[model samples]
Target chain A: MIEVKDLRFVYPNGVEALRGVSLKIEDGEFVAIMGQNGAGKTTLVKHFNGLLKPTKGDVYVDGVNTKDVSVATLARKVGYVFQNPDHQLFCESVEQEVAFALKNFGFDQETIEKRVSWALQLLGLTQYRQVSPFMLSGGERKRVALASVLAWDPKVVILDEPTIGQDYAQKEKLRQFIMQLRTQKKTVVIVTHDVEFVAECQPRIILMKNGKIVADGSAKEILTNPEVLLQASVIPPQITQTFHYLKDIGLPTNVIDVYEARETILEFLGETKK
Target chain B: MRFMVARESVEVIKTEKLTFTYAGRNEPSIRDVGLSIEKGEFVILTGPSGCGKTTLCRCFNGLIPHFYQGKLEGEVIVAGLKVNEHPTYELACHVGLVFQNPENQLFALSVEKDVAFGLENLGLPREEIRKRVDWAMKVAGVYELKDRAPYELSGGQQQRVAIASVLAMRPEVIVLDEPTSFLDPLGAKRIFEDIYKLNQKLGITVILVEHRLDLAAKYATRVIVMNDGRVLLDGDPREVLSLEKTRLLGVGIPKATRLYQLLKNDGIPLKSGKVPLTPEEAAEAIKEAFKSD
Candidate 1:
């Protein structure tokens, strides 16, 4: 759905964030952009929605070049959720926050209400419909932010650090929500530092370093490669590390998730007994 | 050998029947929270987000009523000084507070100027400010970045500069409220390592309000778990972490402890005594289990 060709982005101060990077993301694919701070992951993703224009190269969404489209019009095609929820949320009530983008896109009143309600239901935020956005907790505010973007019904959703500052349950909820988005065939691109979350989600992992794509493959391929993960300042998940150690000890198990690792170990023991 | 020292000094901070209610809110943020911390001890205050951990830390630095107007029912004393009675500037000298967002605390153009801002505000002599600025930067391990701008540094480096700025005052107690929340894992590790060095090497009394239990479990001498504006658990890390109740407390444990628990629950003949703090320790335990089997 998205294609980039030799993309290069430099800030006005002459700091190049994306340096001749290129990648192709298929339609309805869930891709995660992983990198450390200052690795230019955020700068690269901002170009997808036209929040940033590449200084030297081109970014195309569904064969439409971003350089020729207005940011607001592009935003309707590619929704972006920032790292801080407070940066995007300015409405008083939860319902109004979700409907803000729909109204801005000039949707009719009835269609806007329907989209807002559907978005709230999808994120499980309907119960907080009338509550003030400022009074909600951090996790709840993040859900509201997601709903705000999702209400616009964009083809692709880009989330920046969606799981930061969240507890285990909340993170799990977000994980499942992202999976659901993938199953619904809406392209999802997440820029994050949480390696464990990315591992659990098992999306197409794109390792970006110094404003360039270093590795692009399945999560198992990218996560198991210690050299790539280390260069990105990302750690392999504990389960992945365990399997790596077990494999070193002559156990041939390619387990990436915890449940699979448990089953593989149990099966290995059974085979030894046989 | 790590020796457990007997409590030698009176409580530097003691809360008696403390209750704090934010303006226009009927429910109190902190409710009858009675706790005490001895001198020269490291304590971790943690809970789910918006569970009054930040409010409790604010009370320590006289930001409760001095900087914020609120309904306070109980007294909070720091180093025998009542927080409510003193000005925030006076309390700031003795109780240095480092907030979660490093960008909010920094205002100077350069790193050195930011580190020396607090000391200069106290009207210390130029020589003393210079000495303290150098010492604090060295202690916080940001001396190399002295000429850099605060905005130019990474989140972790910026936080270290913020800590250095607070440490320049040489406060008796230093309270950091989720200082590593915004940082990446490596940056988070750097900040906590700095805190550990400060507490161990310099003997600074440290109180951290954090959510990352894996980092806090390794260094904090005491862990204070808060829920619903009250202290839920407080004691040594090993004792508090071993409780089954902690798993249900909604805060996560260290990765090592979780791995150990998973192995033990699977009928692995592992010593289920004290929880390991690092992955290296967990690996050792696994090796020991395999050897015995």
Candidate 2:
């Protein structure tokens, strides 16, 4: 569990990235933080992992104040996959990269090997286990970065832009992986601009703007609210946009899922039993 | 060759049997890819990851054989110059390649300096550099951020600055490798419109590598899909994007197109019998279907 109270943060250069943001993420909750660039979405998530301490408020992670605990201690629970894979990938090979975190956490040699193989296979990087991470493609490298983080089995996994540079198939794989994580009841948080992915996942949505939380609600509520989404610079999913544009034809504007939109349109066309 | 002599050719980019294998890699990244892009065409190159989209883009601007150590075979001619024969510096004037990551390309402290970097390297006059810098910045919609450092800006904003820097060179062929990956949908739409306008007004051939087909499909004159280092499909956007083979390859089909397919599957056909690539087009098609009934 993580909680923030009136969180405010200012960079050393005097740029206030977060302003009095307050939110609470319950245990095993799946959440998505979304907004335009520079809207303080990343700033807010950095607090969850104790990467950035609040300048004026407090962040509590697992019942401990972030200011009191060191970042190393927080690492055991929170695993952050950076926006750029290159920032975190430094091991010589894919296998070593995944094992690096487990070894650091002082896991047994046998456990480290098992976890590394498991992570590589889960992310479809087993074929590249012996290859250098630097030699992989951009998307492949992203998977390597994700494998390295997930190897530690952190309780809370925060993925920053996991869908960027990924293709449709890889994204589907990631979506399934996230669903599997949910079955295990891991707290998953993602900061992204991939609305289609969000529409499919339907995680609890938190919309931020200008360094403050503007809206927080279920995915349907936050995504279909045009006024709130507009303020955050987020465009609704294509199905929602299609339905919204068809509002003049008496179709409902709140449909975010494609299946729901299809049924609603069919019913409106007098082709279905309502 | 230090100087380039203009050749009157309508085909801005052409590749024949182009194959490349990175050093120390057994498998080829690109294989026997043959393509021809006319002047002023906006082409979207999309594929599954590691399918050689970026490697193919590098071949257009002389980066594949020149900068990247690779075994290259066959011919690629961009802006009438054989890429293997011309150095990157000479090709930079005609073909500007915007890298996948904006941070890799932007280096100046301020947006203005970054936009002017390419022009200054060409030994352009100060007045000309100033004029082009302002014009390109405004075109990419980054003029308001002229004094801000690139690092200080958001990912989307920095992407615009990178594009502006490339535009300042007035390259005839601009190949952008997923330039708007960090931008929001609205911002991405605006950038696509800007690139569309440049292609229309200046007749600059655009080769855009991207995966956001939901937003980008409408702007592309043609769509090319690759799989496992081979061109699986290439043609008009509507035709190419609607292929089952393309969909099976895991390319992102525009949601609008998907909706069209779903409707068709349910026995409701749009009046045009064509796939809609954007929401507005889909809405118009549905409205027309309703009116005809």
Output the number of the TM-score-best candidate: 2
Candidate 2 runs further than 4 Å off: A270-274, B1-9, B288-293
TM-score on alpha carbons, each prediction = 0.92, 0.96
* Candidate 1, pairs of clashing residues: none
Which candidate has the highest lDDT of all?
Answer: 2
lDDT of each: 0.82, 0.88
lDDT of 1 by residue, B1-293 (tens): 89998866767899999999977677898888898898778998877666788789899999898766779998899988999898888888888999877888998999999998887888999999999999999998899999999999988899999999999988889999878767766677778888988888877899997666765678888988888888889998877766667767767666556666767788766655567765555555554454423
User: For model 1, how big is the CA root-mean-square deviation?
Assistant: 3.2
Best by DockQ: 2
Alpha-carbon RMSD to native, per candidate:
3.2, 3.8
For all candidates in order, state the fraction of native interface contacts they contain.
0.23, 0.69
After superposing candidate 1 on the true structure, give the runs of residues whose Cα lies further than 4 Å from its correct spot: A117-132, A241-256, A269-274, B1-7
